[model samples]
Target: MDSNDGFDAATKMETPLKEYFDASTWARIHASLQGSLTKRGAGNEGTRQFLDLVLLKAESGIPWSDLPLSHSKIHNVYVRFCRWTDDGVWPPVLEAMSEAPEAQRLLEQLVRNHMIFRRSRKFRSEILKAS
Candidate 1:
């Protein structure tokens, strides 16, 4: 696989959130979170990366040393996840993994997976199931 395959112009612009994600990643995200809220605005780059980080952390079960947060990206992502999953976002960020059809299709093709939630609202860890 090409490590550079998913890199886009946005990833090279000091986009702390965008570095770990791409358009294809966005699509799967949309589909995965279909009914839930906090989807994301049409061109909100930061939110896109933020959402990507959330999913990545949720799936990888790894230590978050590369996110743009002081403590840990996983903590931030869990907070956001509970926020979105609970009452949902006020304006709704267009976050479902299927929000973008093209990205949805490609990402879905690349990945087929689900998450295992912890006992509490806060996630202890996340594991990614292979396609």
Candidate 2:
């Protein structure tokens, strides 16, 4: 096979969590999370790259240093990750992810397996009321 074939396959390979999120869902989450940022650097493109790095690290459970070198520098990625986390960007992103239809099956499975649990009656009641 041609060496280019390997490159093609690699480009087509989808990460697990990446396959779970559709484009519109990702865009919605990105839009919501982007607004929460207190400072902007690298513009919209930079924000997308940072979000991609965050998702990759979270899904793989890998250290930042292990991320693909094709992405932004580890220091830049790490700093942006910390800044976003501090700015409270993550909670809304997480909530959007949980509410996504593509994730509903996994969420149900987690609930079935008791991997996701309700700790307090009041909180449980609030969740149920919202739904």
Candidate 3:
């Protein structure tokens, strides 16, 4: 019996999520976002993880409650996202990211998701007021 089994480098595949950005592109994104997302004692790694989860939600259009547990708690992520939106943090970041060819598609998806979210909230509010 050989120590090495069926693992084959050639057969390895990356998930669709991982295909979004290569190392270099991701680094550029991280650099661009660092100023806004940085927290004392927490390094760039945390921002990277948080951004990954945000991107996942934006790309999938899934409800926050449906996010995977491995990524932080749904409430925490949602709250942070809302806070950022209300604080006007995303506009500049998205604008800067739009200039990068590698980030354009992802930025478009995020923008679309944000618009849909806003419209749905407005509709719900209108329905509540009419009742």
Per lDDT, the best of the predicted structures is 3
Model 1 residue 43 distance off true place after TM-score fit, in angstroms: 7.0
Writing each residue's lDDT as its tens digit, candidate 1 over 25-102 gives 556554444454434443344456665665455445444554445454446655665565445341233334434444
Off by over 4 Å in 2: 1-20, 41-43, 70-72, 99-131
Q: Tell me each candidate's TM-score.
A: 0.36, 0.52, 0.56
Query: Which candidate leads the pack in TM-score?
Result: 3
Order the candidates by TM-score, highest first: 3, 2, 1
Instruction: Give the per-residue lDDT digits (tens) of candidate 2, residues 41-109.
Output: 424655655555566665556766776643346777777666555465556766667656545444334
Candidate 2 all-Cα RMSD: 11.5
Worst 10 residues of 3 by lDDT: 10-19
Better of 1 and 2 by lDDT: 2
Residue 1 miss distance in model 2 (angstroms): 18
Query: If the candidates were sorted by their lDDT against the true structure, best first, what order would they fall in?
Result: 3, 2, 1
- Clash counts for the predictions, in order: 12, 0, 0
RMSD of 1: 11.6
